[model samples]
Target: MTDDKIQELIGRCAERDVLAFEQLVRQFQSYAFALAMRLLCNEEEASDAVQESFVRVWKHLDRYDRGRKFTTWLYTIVTNISLDRLRAIKRNRRLFSSRDEDPSIDDIQDERDLHEIHSNEELAGMIRALTDELPLKQRLVFTLRDLQDLSVEEVSEASGMSIGSVKTNLHYARRRIRQRMAEKYNVERLES
Candidate 1:
């Protein structure tokens, strides 16, 4: 939808128009859920985080600044909620363990279709698994900028980080992902 249309929806939403809110939700829900999934590294938690973020957005609709890009504001809300959920889950796990854990392929919900980003199921699984190895900041930067195709400025604004920080995090994220993918490829080659 165009910015003008979204602005109209936001205006209506601020007035408590349920239908307008639904329209906005329908437009953005998939992307928001995708982002949350990448950030939390779990399907169920991502769904919950998106739901909670939308609820918060609904409650604070009147507080939204019309001067800003609505999607950027929406991303900010979703990212904050997902990060909080991630931190809470991590904290609980840390309380019960003495070491950090890496998410395995089994933990990721594979939903890629043949026409989607990656047609190779095995490669898709490897990418998802390797993504979980990044630090939280790096993961968010990589997901927003590279996966979601947001510009550096948009990612910086959405993530509430400086442009330089976003660039730095994205640099580290790409480097780590490349290193992990290469290592995995080498292992599979050797096994064969």
Candidate 2:
């Protein structure tokens, strides 16, 4: 949807117009879910996060700044909620058991062809798998900047990080992911 249309919907939503709120949800729900899924890596949790995000959005519509992009604000909410869900899962898992073993990077054969990775879905899955080994901040920055295709500034806004922090995290995140990818598939070089 166009920014103007989204802004109009937001304006109506702010006035407590239920239909406009519904329309706004329809317009952005998929984007929100996609982001949540990338962050959470589980469909059920992603759905829950998106639902909670919309609820929060509805409750706090008045606080949304008109000058900033609506998506930036929405993404901020989703990122924060997703991070909370991740922390909760970690806490719960810790209560139940000891730490999970790290996947053996040594199992990846060096001769696998990168060209064989044809589907975007497969590549995305591989990237997500690689990201599972990253620290939370690096994963967030990498997902927001590279996977979600947000600008650095937009990632910073969404993640509530300083621009410099986002860049630094993204640099390390990309470098690490690329190293893993090369080790997995034997690529000669990867661009940062």
The per-candidate count of clashes, in order, stands at 0, 0
Worst 10 residues of 2 by lDDT: 101-110
| RMSD to the hidden true structure, all candidates | 5.1, 3.4
**What overall lDDT goes with each candidate model?**
0.79, 0.84
- By TM-score, who's the top model here? 2
Report the CA-based lDDT of candidate 1 relative to the real structure: 0.79
Model 2, 1-192: lDDT tens digits are 888999999999999999999999998999999899888877788899999999999999999999999999999999999999988876876788544432234433444523356654545455556787788999999999888899999998999899999999999988997798776666675443
Badly placed stretches (over 4 Å) of model 2 are 97-125, 189-192
TM-score of each: 0.80, 0.84
List the candidate 1 regions with Cα displacement exceeding 4 Å: 97-128, 187-192
